[model samples]
Target: MATDELAGVQSVESVQSETTTKRYPVAPGVQLNVRSGPGTGYPVVKVLPTGVSVPINCQCPGTTVAGPYGTSNIWDNIANGQYVSDAYVRTGSDGYVAVRCG
Candidate 1:
């Protein structure tokens, strides 16, 4: 392979390694309300306890619709590839969280 090609591969590998993701343990015993939407009015789709580490898929800022929200906030099926919100997963046992791939 050419030297340029080798350099490109190394660059890509370094970038991928530098980017790290985080997980959070769902609040214990508190069956967190998985909303169908980002906000409360969206409806409680399901609930799960703590120790369930969900991947932080994407994050959205607080809007008038989803009041009292904050950073590392609202997550959804569609996300900006940062933090995750409760709406990013399906309801019920063994539900899996969504991850932003791209």
Candidate 2:
């Protein structure tokens, strides 16, 4: 392929990686609650099945919670208006993994 074409392909791959959604495993044996907001005070929008992984779109601080991983106030936004406690997510860190929600 021509140099320009190869460069374009490489550029596309770079963008794809940057925009790709990253999924994190939930704590074992837990049917996690998906809340409307970043806290327990928010109503449960749904429940995630056991052994499921979730893509955290963003993170924000909210009600502190204790879970299998540890205690934390960071909530992961899995979708629009949907959030789960980061404490239950095995993100390998005790702090925010994704960009803070705008």
TM-scores of all candidate predictions against the true structure: 0.41, 0.83
Worst 10 residues of 2 by lDDT: 14-23
Q: Write the per-residue lDDT of candidate 2 for residues 25-84, one digit (tens) a residue.
A: 999999999999999999999999999999999999999999999999999999999999
Model 1 alpha-carbon drift over 4 Å, by segment = 1-21, 63-102
Best by lDDT: 2
- What lDDT does model 1 reach? 0.46
**When superposed on Cα atoms, how far off is each prediction in RMSD?**
9.6, 3.3
Clash count of each predicted structure: 2, 0
What would the per-residue lDDT of candidate 1 be over residues 1-102, giving only the tens digit for each residue? 999999999999998865654555554444555655555556665665645665455433432232122223335433232222543333231333344333
Q: How does each model score on lDDT?
A: 0.46, 0.96
Over 4 Å off in model 2, which ranges? 1-19
Worst 10 residues of 1 by lDDT: 62-71
